[model samples]
Target: MTLWPGLAADAAAQACPAGWPQWDAFARRHVQADGRVVDFSVPEQQSTSESQSYGMFFALAANDRARFAAIWRWSRDNLGAGSDKLPAWQWGRREGGSFGVIDPNAASDADLWFAYALLEAARLWQMPDYLKAGMALLGQVKAQEVRVMGDLGPMLLPGPVGFEAGRERWRLNPSYLPLPLLRRFAAVDPSGPWTAMVQGAARLATQSAPQGFAPDWVIYDAGKGFQPDSERSVLGSYDAIRVYLWAGVTNDGDPLVAAVRNALAPMTRAVVSYAAPPEKINTVTGAPEGRGPIGFSAALLPWLKATGAADALAAQEALVREKWQTWSRAAHPAGAAGDGEFNYYNSVLSLFGWGWLQGQYRFDAAGQVTPAWACAA
Candidate 1:
């Protein structure tokens, strides 16, 4: 999808500052030359619209305009398939044929990231095309993916299709709603449902976790309220971890900020009690499953700090730092796509959680990012 007209080749403008090299290293290791962020642990060497959207955000945060453009290009030409403004969620090697999008359904979280990153890139870098594209895609997301439940107000469906399990019910992913992004979207269009989504999102987090653990998926009963998705298992693991990370890093004073803190506060105790957050928790029962991996520690650092659990923050930071070394060793000569310890998802979480904690990026109340370089400037 080599459609971008061109970009200047100045290294200084194209790269993050020398001191902030982790993102650069991460791109080098995981992002392919074709602008695809490949998750190697998956046997198919799959790519997701979510990864592309995330890479765009990181590139914008690092001020790497070139990589951001390339990622956008690849996602549009490949996942978007040159037709849809919204890119398909998953792309990979098919069982019998060439590599391409396996499904055309747009994932709401990925679409949200794509729109948010594009608009923010426009603001941060003065790319008007990015802003225009972002607005267009945002409309598609709202038209095709967002819905108003019987009582839940406006809500983002997990995808454009297939989330409706049956009549009068829809499945929702809480982590899909980034509070800061919702605020930003509302800023873009005051009359948009984004603001209502902010309220609905807060309600989602607080109500879904009766026991203080967000579920990976919840069902809106139209009558009863948010309930656990038995198909996804009641356990909160990979998908739900990011909920805490996003909530913690959200700007203070957001309407949902207090709700996030209060709803997830038990995680602070979990970290202190176990020296690490549990790897899996039954969201309904609030029971521990196992000692969460190093990445879980990484994910909790910002949340721990946000909740004023200094000792817990310190413990997680220490564990996260130790795991960074493990990543280095696992990545040095052997490589980054390892088996158990430093996998693709773990690396991604570390980048977001640890990077936020270490001051690589911060989202303002309006969700405008003050990246590390911009901070110093």
Candidate 2:
């Protein structure tokens, strides 16, 4: 019942002849000349904190330090708005660079993610200015909108709309989004507001998922606590595991890691039993979602490596190999899938997986040194 067969053997080819070339083509197609990566080639002129963060990391992975630096600079200069301004909005128009959309305003989880991205960029580049900008944005988050959940502790709310009212909506996604920012902040400025917010969000998320499985979504009301609903997303849980792993390794006595470990056990079991080729079981339920291709399989590798579950990592590697082989055989010589706009976004995920498998990571499950290929040299 898996999506593709023989994928594992194909992924084990070690290196694909056209892999890097295909990846480079994908990056060139999506990344605009101005250094900003558009989100999914949408016509409305929108960019994303997640895309920017991944884009920067991939650029660094490819040894394009200048592009990485340029993206970070453009993000800060245009996305940050002004002095003492909050982090960038989730979505905005390229024309005037405003951040007032219903889906991507400043106060949403994406803003915090942008701050986290800057923190990572600063760490990689060792530039004090990026760290300063990250800290400034974190300070704004704490000063303007973080709230306390009775037992859950401090959490961030969505920021203001057009200089007036705040969104005040609490989301589950930010719980994972802010951890990297906190980890980086803790390394430099241990006593800063970002550190506190990180702890608060972890506590709240853990408490909310007492059953060890978080609901797909939740809405946080100012007066009331977290209200659970059925709008669940497998991607959200997958991202949450990454955040918890980061916290567990970076900070001492992290309960979030324990919760995630327990929650993911069933999903891992399902994959072991039934996952064929490129398919992954739903983290919440044991059912197969579909064939994950390269991107999703790649994203899961970090978590698998972080957990030190060798079997899981092996399974994922097999799936990735299948995807690469399939793409290689079917696609034309240019690496384009014949789709103009939807070029290689999915390939970014594959590159990330390949990079990690080749030992490009900040921390491992055992806290050993695993540097990127370029960094290792």
Candidate 3:
């Protein structure tokens, strides 16, 4: 699991500039000294592969190699990541009071992020070992999670198992497929199915949103194409929020950027009209359920800025700024986890959307990572 040899101290010495206050606050409050990101809001006090992967990305974005290595280490040592087997999705206190892995199942989104972060870290930090590790993980992803449907060419599954309902039917999560990650994978491994995944991802985003709102999940049949997930129905909520975030951060030079924005234009209009992102929505009718949590506004920042929704972006920005103080207070009243409006998932989202809006990081059309330090240098 130790990918780098004898470079631990050197990595710490090479820590990137500390200029991002938002990231600083996050690392202090969310991530522990051992590099595990805990979701204290959950009763289980769980740590997931998603949390680890996102922490790696944020660390890399901040140019903090030591923290990145620490996060990777904890994930590999605890969750068995950085190996042939996909990382376990959840680790927390169990029923009997022992702390360990709760679910052995893998999450494809976290896997993709792990690979993406590793590969980019190699490029940015000039660590070829990371490139090798990333490539190996990418191979596992292709073998275990990717499948060529009956007529759909190659598509990504939600995980390595349990997603295929039948030979002609499959369950898919639209939010799991981020276009930038697909593009970056294709660039690294031209022969891989990552290219086809880009197109398939576009189809999912557009077709699943029949009414300009992405759903949390969808079903893809042999001939019927994409359909609203029967179990989850057409509800667009937490998972779907990342759809807009991904689309917004995609480089404008990418061919599919315009198409994705156009397909999800209603969200832009809705946010503009309401001056806040809806927490939940019916994808079929484009009907909003209610005003989303403050994090929803934070999540929509990049999309709003990219789409030229100045007034809406400003409104949400103000809301996030105002609410973040309350959230921080509620989350840390006694210097401990609070049972208030504070949410770990929302905090993660805010870090991502708000950090990007603040120019902490950006992705090229090829999905290359560009830390603000790189630009400044």
Candidate 4:
């Protein structure tokens, strides 16, 4: 088992940092006072449910209840997030220059994360309101997001609509199903299809990566197995990076961990060969192209450590640490990192990757979060 810093009273003497400076920096750069996580990189300056969900999870992990409540409020007010409605996936400046929801469609992954964060927060903070909201939202997820495929049993679609390409063909994003969350849901909602989803998720992770490289999106035929998505081809890039992150941070004792890790072994080799993860790859041919962004390096940290690629992990750690100093740590006058306007996604990735390395938090076998303070207490 990984020994998290501050797990013991003497941990402070071991020179662990006082708090999560990275998360503090992220909040300043991306999160607004109104608790909206705006991506200033794009002209729309969009706020997606994914961003809000990530914000809530990070806040919970940092034990910042006030910020958590604020973020939840903004999402509830703007994104239509509540027990009765699945949060709208995207909000931004509209064509008329007025800010509003750009897309009414809900992203199932964000829905899961939102529910997970709320459920965990309720348990950790002993708040019944959070629990009530979480269970009700989870009910919506079960009703709308899950579908019974021909033989795949209960599989999670990417959203409530538009993903079912045909009567028998369905589009799936493998990265959306984090094993840890599935484990937690299985424990919390045993009567639901969470257990069956766990098994299906394992197949998605392993079978989708026939060449040991996960595709950004895959097509699942009712009778046939997984195939490269027609729209996305065989490419793996931004969306697939989270697959490694999810697999890496999953508790080692989970029965499906080894299979998922083995399926993603090619990523480790690519990182070693190029000295960093590739920005994109042809999942079918195992051909890589271009050096990935700093966020890609950050995304690989936990996976490298988990896979025992010590040298690769060191290199990525060094690169991330070096580049991290280039960005400002305070809220800028323009409400975005000037040159690092694209920092929102990278920062979230780092929070998950470097945060794990720094011992800020961890996931148990049942997918319960173990924040550093919780361990110390």
Regions more than 4 Å wrong, model 3: 1-18, 326-335, 338-342
lDDT of 4 by residue, 31-104 (tens): 88889987777788899999999999999989988889989999989998884789999999999999999999
Q: TM-scores, in order shown? A: 0.92, 0.68, 0.92, 0.94
lDDT of each residue in 46-155, candidate 1, tens digit only: 88988899998889878888888999999988988224557889999888868888887888899999999999998888889999989889988888888889888889
Q: Which ten residues in a row have the lowest lDDT in candidate 3?
A: 1-10
Better of 1 and 2 by TM-score: 1
Q: Rank the candidates by lDDT, best first.
A: 4, 3, 1, 2
Tens digits of per-residue lDDT, candidate 2, 1-377, equal 12111123344322212124544655565566666766544544456655666676666555567777777666666566325765455555545665434243464454555555556556666777767876676677666655654444565554544321225445544344435445455565566555566656555555445344333345555556555533444433434434433432332234345554454454444445555322433434434556544555565565565455678778777777775666555533332333332234455555555554543444422222222433333
Model 3, span 159-217: residue lDDT tens: 98889876688998888988899999999999999998899889888888988999998
| Model 2 whole-model lDDT (C-alpha atoms) | 0.51
- Reference-based lDDT, each prediction: 0.80, 0.51, 0.84, 0.86
Best by lDDT: 4
Stretches of candidate 4 above 4 Å error? 5-17, 329-334, 337-342
Whose lDDT is higher: candidate 1's or candidate 2's? 1
Per-candidate RMSD vs. true structure?
Answer: 6.7, 7.7, 6.8, 2.8
lDDT of 3 at 315: 88
Error of 1 at 64 (Å): 1.2
Q: Least accurate stretch of 10 residues (summed lDDT) in model 1?
A: 1-10
Clashing pairs in 2: 7-322, 11-321, 107-158, 107-159, 216-232
Clashes of 1: 0
Evaluated at residue 17, the lDDT of candidate 1 is: 31
